[model samples]
Target: MPTDAHPAAPRPAVDHDVLIVGGGHNGLTAAAYLARTGKRVLLLERDDHLGGAAVSAEAFEGVDARLSRYSYLVSLLPQRIVDDLGLDVRLVRRRFSSYTPDPRDPSRGLLVDGEADAASARDAFARVGAEGDAEAWQAFYAETARVAERLFPTLTEPLPTRAEARSLIADEHAWDAFVERPLGETIDARFADDLVRGVVATDGLIGTFTDLDDPSLDANRCFLYHVIGGGTGDWDVPVGGMGAVSGELARVAREAGAVLRTDAEVVAIDGDSGEVRWREGGVDRTARAHVVLAGVAPVVLDRLVAAAAGTASGATEPSAGAAASVAPRDEPAAGAHSDEVPLDAGARHRLARAGMPEGAQVKVNLLLTRLPRLADASVAPEQAFAGTFHINELETQLDAAYRRAAAGDLPDPLPCEIYCHTLSDRTILGTGLAESEAQTLTVFGLHVPDRLVDAHGNDELRERLRDAVLASLDSVLAEPIADVIAMDAAGRPCIEVKTTRDLEHALNMPGGNIFHGTLSWPWLEPGAEAATPADRWGVATAHPRVLMCGSGAVRGGAVSGIGGHNAAMAVLEEELP
Candidate 1:
């Protein structure tokens, strides 16, 4: 197999065919693919551990639970990446799709069982006075399934034009509902029940903070990504937690002869000369490469390149809750950053438009003594919490919450969802914990924008938001959720709440925007350019030698490796010596 000579030898200066910044899952993926082609690949990560957000950690002190700390669940990960790398990753499909308790009556709710018969689901819908929605729900997802079948395959291929993608989807009605019009209008037209409509709309608002009726239709983009995963949109639990996914990728990359280094922070990159400078353990170093794959947000890339050209300002660290506004799509005027290092005009425009990304959700992890009882008597607690358990997310409630949050006030009865990881996979629990029937709960709160964190300090807002979220969950439960929380060894409550500000400090994610930045349309606009191979693959930067291999890439989002895969494909298209 092709390998970097003397893999363990330390070199002050070395030249590699490909140098990747950030050892997140995407970086690892790019390294494995490039190294398998006999190219010398070097990956550097700022954190001591490899995985970025996709990792499992023993969060509670003296608690034996290994929770998927940041990013939970697996949906968009392609089977192709697994087969290509021969990764030993197992994902467990939850039998239930989601259970949303009715806000008007906690005892009545809708439970969607994936393994149940059509009549069973219809009965559940009937209980919530949404019997008419059962047929509409199936039809809506059926259309998405068709779109998924067509659109998912193009993710790994070269960029498809707007016209090309529309043609591929074939169904004009489906395209109009998801691609052309605002999602709110379509949901309003199709579904009659508020709770049922909210169930569908929740997918649109996951990490994005946007009004459903916004003409820009950014929510449509987010919704499309949620429903098109793995051509089925079935979010499965990763066996042994999210860390297993990254661990397998790291292993495959290492075994394929890629050099991986942790705690190495890349400070600058000279795009013209392909020189990268990084600091590790208080020691500064440099390396040259034929190509550089930036596995970071676009805004961060601009800062690095600016620093290399000596045109950057004194402020190197990104501020918390950076610009929460949606980036304008129009090409911005010049005179922002300098024009050195072949920074493309459009790339600069994108940077200027990209204010700090604003992540919208608040994540709270809890290790519970046992599953809390649901108010809905017909459905057992195990069945309701197994999948996504949504609370206070009715269509009207979601809109009202957005209004309140946009007005700089915290939404009362915060809309959120809960996922019981232990229900599907018991291995995440320690031997003692598992034997005692302990469970782990991952709560994701919607409409909790970074702006709130900016208005209220992280410490203050964390507690307030945590209280609000638990209260919302409590609204649907038989007893208070706080009573069931397991205590850590030190007598502290085993609850971990991460606000966007917290994410920014912990993960170097500017604005804590989970997708790196607002997600872009998978296909280029009608008149957009795609002249180069990198451009065609949607991984291009201003510099020809540099490409994006992170969530910031056109088709990149969630746990999917499309960005890295396409970046490798783009590099492989060129003849490399």
Candidate 2:
């Protein structure tokens, strides 16, 4: 909880001019934009805490405290790095409004789900031919805020190159009326119902595993209409929980000199011939830098980059002739971390390790003694989100939970979004951060893709997927969450048990599939990601001076870390661009 960086201990030559490796929040926004420009950065964090799910703890030593773990939420976190990292001073506020219980609208369980979703989207835009209040919901929020201001400068720029989106697409119409509409036929031609076209087509298909009747799930609702737009309506929070946005981006990555070690634990990274054969917590070191920026999960870097490109007998088969004879193509570098790391190779490298799973979106936090009170009596005790709930329910119950996740099964109708900023922040849960009758409630339940733990009812399918997601939150909290119980901690609860397969033994990513690969839209087409697929995964295919960011490198997954902010701006354009 006290983070300004540098305190996780047991260090030595775990090396780095820049090493990063998962301190989340896009590895602290690429170590506060690459240690402010000086560059000898180090940042590790296997966890001595630094806001991974944007943190906020004390699950039950008393009760009631919550954040987006109810799949914690953040909407386009930039606002000039939230006013150059002041983060609206320790931000926290959850009482959100978004619900749908549907047994055929039984009074939509009590409507006030966002003012009955903004008066059923202005009587679904005055019955589709548009025109109603706030001038037809301000011309449908001014054409969804011009498709969220030209898709928020290409979702934070970086991926340019269709000749840079065709020279930023000639005289813009906002890229021809919002990136080529379609999103469930532009919300069923401006809604009327189907619950406001299933909440504007469920944020254009959230972090892809696609299903709101699929067609690339209407680009996940044009990427949640660009976090629903900032004059305030989407979400953002920082303040005293979720470790104050990783303690102010680790105090802007230690006032930009950067070196935070904290509970160290490198164990061994060894990319060999080029350097970085680290070993921290137990000792045995060696450095010169093998470039890391990890945020982990690409099958723990193909078994720590094939045990740092194996020099002395380490092949329990990477095969393809032992990954080109333990990486030779001109010996790039990296090595260490052995005593054979396998557990399904860490689940087949969390399932093939390609990229983007929306940071595995499964967080649950609850510490309660009572105070969720929401069966929807038309909602207004300060518009009740006290502090948050973002679930976009019903589009055939979230496309039958992604058609039971394309067939692996784990969704008996479950798709959630919630928040509890201890009933409106007041310096962390209305002061007394809930330590006596209980407080903490955060649930972001989306299961049906990675089957959270049923390798065969393992520990009774992890408590039958946490009592079938608290019996689907007893179908909307008007009274029975048994007055908010006490203590529960799923966030990183030991690599999220059910299996971290020996803290991700190595390539066992199959059922773990934490996006070492596969957001599969033809692996993001157009030049199809630079390397791997035979180009031999990145960091210059072993180590050119090293560069590879987590969720297993390459535009991988959409936890929106952009593979450690585009591998720390391509290692600051190869050392000082």
Candidate 3:
């Protein structure tokens, strides 16, 4: 709990070339790039640790299993950032793509083995009565692959106009399917099987609470990000878990001469003057910089900016409680703003539109004594659990789940996916645990929005949701999942559940929305404004000095460093002060 300044005597205000708030992976990326250019950079993190939602920890008591506690898997991170920063992290591609067991008949399942030939995949699809979908699947992904190759390279560059991006894609049919029309229409037209269609549609719903046919096209944006990672749809597992990814970024930033401080909670930011106020070790400190990079949600940034303005004008101090409260989907949090700070028209409009994002997911981490046996005896447990294991997530089932959850009720037979990190890399476990064949399962339950948690208290709903998720998992398993769960040294079950409320309290993400808010289209619409370099990069805020460098930025979702990279590029475009 070290402080940036002494408690007895506050330090004089300091100045830097660039000041970054929130020391997440994106913030660390900005610090590394900016500091390497010989610009003085300072990064402050509220928590004791650096990584935001991208850290690995031993969840079970004395388990010695370093599980990725929150965000697992890497799909959107660019190799250019890794090569530029000289990150020493390694990512392993899963041999099996995915395996989804038929909920109607547990004996039949669809297994997508990456190593298997096309004929093998066709046969696997045939087993689940989706033989025709095999060719459709290939065709759909092939189209996405083409889009990825053309669009991914532009993520780290300046923003492209809608027409410019469409022209670059060079395929009107692909554009009409993925970009123009509703994603649901494309899935319906291309795939005949319900399960196959669901597999394709799940990408559109990850961490995003939206229907495929929504006019906003948020689901389409989510799907695009899922498939365009590193110019491919492959989501690789980090060797030492997600911590390795952040650890490398931290090392690079520090080596590049960026000053990163933990346990330093930034309370206010003056966008007009580039001044930042923070609390550390019970002391208040002030710092000013030429540019400010915010690695936070837009809603949170609005509060900070307002707080700063209020302090300057001798208004009442704003409460930080909103950062920890659970908000309904597409609704503003109670006590989110203060009337003491009058907002301009632009700020008011931004807040009204942004509201508080609601994350529709429940993450569960479990340590198993052994992998569960699948009802479909043809597929081995290792193969089934190697990649994403879909459970009760057919197209019809997913729609029903969404409808139920939207009505303030829990979905029956919740749809979820499981990933076994240990199968791809054993480095996360201790030698004894690895030798004992212990495995870790990361379960991500979909369609369970924060609204449900708000209705049912987090504590009561956590247990209920855990039971429901396990029940859904048991449907596809040969034996009860509880039978295989390992016990920790404290004689407790080696399972941990994290709800949206838990995320809000732990990560400061409003409503536990992982992407900070809704995903934005990568390109700007026709007649849109891009007057500044930051705007051109799609990282601009209302103020010229402040820029977004996190998941809130356009093209800035998932574990990708594109947001940070693009923000830095925008700053570098300006002449050095």
Candidate 4:
């Protein structure tokens, strides 16, 4: 084991073998791997702390709940990385995967139990007219598992050709349904129940704002990442919140001799020269490295480089919900939507062609005094909220919401998922709060697309959206969700809302996209057949030495360290001459 540096120790060497921009989890993962290889790695973050969006914090003032504010839950993080890094983290699997209450029948609801509870699992499916779907569900997931087994391990390895990958799966029908065809078509064909179909379809719309049957098959890309995580697609709750995950990664990196620094914002990167400029302690600083792995999104990297080279007006991009003439980078070929992004037409053209990924999801964290009474009296509140409690997420409901959102309007009844993390782990709440039956609830609203928010006046829009979400919740619950409140010191309800605007302003996430950008096919598609081995890793940039170690990489997005892992692999390997 390498010696670890004290947190208060002076900065290490200015020059390093690798300089990772952005002290996010992915950056920390890269630093850890590179350090293990005996490379001199240095990580820089703009914020005062590590763990970019993956950190847990006391969101509401005067509240003891340490919430996973930005990105919650873990599905993509590989256990292999945990073992390899010797990370001290525990992931608890909920016994109940989800419980969707039937609006037509308040007394009964669909409850998806863990695999061990086969009886309950069957009962839930049967109640929803998905008795056949239980078997179909198993068959469908078995194929995903096969795909996962074949594909997940390759994420850390060099990128394989499309043909090579297909040969490994060796299932033509599976490929056609999952890869070639629209996810909506596959979901409708596989499951007879509209409710069941919507449950599966939600995976495709996690962060993507697109039509289910869009020609680009963007939803398929999103769905694949959601399910293929760790080859099992099981989303587990991280013990001690998400901060534990990133904190452990930072520790592993530091223990392995990686120098980590926060509040050291990287202002510019010259990929050709392997030079990085940053601001620290009220002074500009420069560092040299053989490789510069950017943990930031591609659009951010472009702006940083452009600003340093005097091509753009400055480093800062326009805030989210704003109308910008210059397109966000790595956006789909849709169009430009953000306000005045001071970039050249060539740069804007590039971003426009990629098409912008606008976020539609709204995250709300609440500290409830006690669990609300469920409409389905048969199921205990503890079991119903333990995992995901589906509200207004039926197939027809989801379709209606999606259509409205796609038309730049907020859905009437927002399709959202609610889960109480405290039911599984009571450690998130303060001792005083935890003892008194206080719990933390995380609600994620779908179909509240970025277009719905008024960029110039989002406060009103956000308030309206929040009200709509609460109203939607009230429709399913026996009592109004707002009635059971834990007041703050100021006597206000202990609840915090995060809109797409909040994401954009707080985390610099353009259009509030949680995945950083639109999800793309992890492997080489038809047009990308010409990509090189490095390009296949999705880490390669126009500049040879500047690799993307963040969610922008191929097989990227989610909380998984695949992007970081692939970036490190790219650096360690030799390119084909």
Candidate 5:
């Protein structure tokens, strides 16, 4: 599992069956799927580790270990890939306990629905309603749950074809005439109260830039219909953490038959059909494969392939496919431009990052001398399950916090998410390293932006960001959780952004935007932009031998190894069996 210390030089063809670039979740998943299916796959990652965003770094001496310092939360993953990849080995999918405090009446709006007691919870939820709203909400869930149940079989059944859709639409009406409706609109129609509706609607709009008011949000909600509670609840982390999920995928892929190389930064990708070119171990090597599968972003492929073919221009508009899906326009959208982003992001990109320190992000891991004591008794006394608690301010407040960070000064009130890993496994971080207490607080922070990296690698801004986080935590409760700190801060600033950025940088993708091409509601489902479609990035078009398997390919974003699995199936179905 040792990773390369140096970068691979400019290279030629390094032979491989399916040469995969990048070792993040998508790349790893694709590698595992291919390897498991008996395809000769070689995975290269720039980072020393394999998890990508699902990484678990040991920062601060004697710090309790956990998944990616930045990325957390899951259960939105497709179940088909979970069982297929045998992720149960490391996938500890557990939903954390969620609480939203109403400073006025702490108990009223604190608990997330599923964690609430059904009878009393229903009564409490009804409080958000006018008179008879509680039963209405429950009835709505029951109805949606049934549709969600019926939608299960389609998740693993390959991308939807037009014919397939016609045959499959057998009374299962998850998406009806109101497909493009926003979840907010649906919430408005379903309930009246602001607090009640906000808590429930949070589930529908977790990922995606689309505000709750965005029309495509409804389809986002439909995605939840396919998830089954692994006995926990609707939302849960996969067992250990995000690392476990990707680690499990790595195990499955390695066990199947894939060879992985880490820190193998692919300087260039050469050749087209029936062969793959890559550099590894700081030596140029040629890998020959019937198909080349990529698990990074499409932009990575665009760059590698474009560089291989030699292009005058080295970039495309970000989200070109999504923009393309809407309509064809002559001129590009403002700021939808690109070029080689030397080292850190360019000025425009920095503007996009807003007011963060150069290459610095605000990440704080609190290893509590004890568990966090929520002021609310509901979460405090029982502290039943280990789950993620979101410290979400109103949208306006949250936006203002980011605006402040954009201004290069720490926000007065930082937003954070506290995850409890010890609640489920009491001996969580204390397993090997014997310790008296455990740190249940794991925070995902964005108070520090990537615009913070200075020439001399200064960390003055990082310290301030950390202080603001602790201050925020202290503000929540009278007693300082830092008082019980056994571990130090966890996350640090680096070029690695989200998994989307990971895919792009690793694979030379154009924008690093996941979801292959388009991100519309129609694209994610079985019907239009499924895996088997022809308009995909490199999977379907690049080469007869190359299979696209990265986050941009198919079965994307999350830890599901669908991109690799589907690519392997593409090659295997055609060439192997």
Candidate 6:
């Protein structure tokens, strides 16, 4: 708590070119890239292991299932980074994109396949919607697919000027539909069916806490990242588990001579001097570097800076001509905060403007004795459960859930989605359980905002929400799902629910936001010019020596290491070839 980046006590010291805070995927990525470039790097993690929220674990005690607990799928990670690091990882394409059973008639459902079975897909869409709307669905996604192709490659490259990106696509309507207007307006104009429109709209609200009709266009930004993050907009499954991603990155970083320490909790940071103070082995320690890559939430960074402010020397005064260098010229002067200044004051201003990020998704992991029977008799459980299963997620229901949550209550059934990881990868289940009988079900509930937990508390609300979700699932199943649940050694059902509060406490994700901040468009305003090359990189902070390598940076959501890769690229002044 002393918050000394350069500990006054003069204990053992370590020196590195880059000191990375938080050993999540982003930090590991930064460390791996910088160390591979022959820069000395030191990475520290407070958790026992790395990967941050992109980790897999056995949520249920006495269960053999290793489920992707918090963050489930992979869509944002770039293949360029994968090949660059020579990561030994396997990503399996999902056979289907989603399957939604109609609550009115349980036997009816809509299924979207990955193999482009156009006739079958159109027929499925027609079951719950007009044939014309189904046709509109096809046209709409075709447009998004084009945007995906043109946009995803730019993520690894320098941040494109918004105009440059729009020019690359060469479609004014495409730009207006995705970038300029609210996504709900676009969804409304294209899709007529409530269920179909909701299916398309859900892409925009995964981790974002906002209304579909909100003018902020925050939902559009989230939708853009989801559809275009992987260059193809396809969300694949990491064969072993989500951990395979960060674990492989950790191996690469360590092999590259980057020093990594676990249980090393960073207490304070001096962004001006590029110094970090942390507690390791029950002792305070310090490290110095030319750069400090903060792979943490903005809230966490603020606390660290506030703690280190008192110890910082008279470097607080704004340096001569530093204003132009510290802030983007297109933005206001106040937007720039000198790295040499006492960051507490500036941090407060930015923190207030950034606002607190609150995640609205509930992660529920369940070990099933067998895949549940589907009410849609025509569709097999294997194919239906192979991808995302939507329950009470019609546009009307989804919108209603948002309103209900805003009014301090959970929806009647709670709009949610489910996927069985074992349907694609049996490696996660042990030998005895891998014989197709045992499986893992991961559920994500939407519109269950953080305030719900604050109002009900974790204990009372978790059970109520869990029961509602189970009942909702049963509404679409042939039989009660609870009957086929695998039991733990304690005879308890192998079901574990993690609320927003649970994530906040467990992962240190302020408000349980998986992205660490509100998702933003990858590019700056169309005509805005960057003040410096680092500004074009999008990873550089107002603090010159410190850069963001987390989800808070541009192009920095999901399991993507774009932020980490960009931060390293900025420090090394390296650009993609």
TM-score of each: 0.91, 0.31, 0.91, 0.88, 0.73, 0.89
CA-lDDT, candidates in order: 0.86, 0.48, 0.86, 0.79, 0.50, 0.81
Residue 512 of model 5: what lDDT? 31
Model 1 regions lying over 4 Å from their true place: 1-14, 314-354
Which of candidates 5 and 6 is the stronger one according to TM-score?
A: 6
For model 2, residues 160-243, the per-residue Cα lDDT tens digits are 443444344453543433344445555555554554455445555543455543454436433543443442445555445555
Lowest lDDT 10-residue stretch of candidate 6 = 320-329
Winner on lDDT between 1 and 6 is 1
lDDT of 1: 0.86
TM-score of 2: 0.31
lDDT (tens digit, per residue) of candidate 4 on 457-496: 4787778777887887888788999999688888988878
Candidate 5 positional error at 35, Å: 3.1
lDDT of 3 at 31: 95
Q: Candidate 5 local accuracy as lDDT?
A: 0.50
Backbone N/Cα/C clashes per model? 0, 95, 0, 12, 51, 0
lDDT of 3 by residue, 211-232 (tens): 7788888889989999988888
Q: Positional deviation of 251 in candidate 6, in angstroms?
A: 0.7
Candidate achieving higher TM-score, 1 or 6: 1
Report the candidate with higher TM-score, 1 versus 2. Answer: 1
Give the Cα RMSD of candidate 1: 7.2
Regions of candidate 3 where Cα sits further than 4 Å from its true position: 1-14, 311-354
The sequence of per-residue lDDT tens digits that candidate 6 reaches over residues 1-577 is 4566654564324477789999989999999999998898899999889989878887777777788888878888889999999999898899798998987688989888878677876787778755678778778888888899998999998888777888987889989999889999999998888888888899998878789889999899999988885767888889989988889999999999999999999988887777889998899998877788888876566556645675222123331111111111122234345666555644543433333467888888899999889889889998888888888888888888888889999888788889888989988887888975888898988888887876787899899888988998999999999998999988999989998879877887767888877776788765654775567778766577777888777788789888899888988883321
Clashes of 6: 0
What is the C-alpha local distance difference test score of candidate 6? 0.81
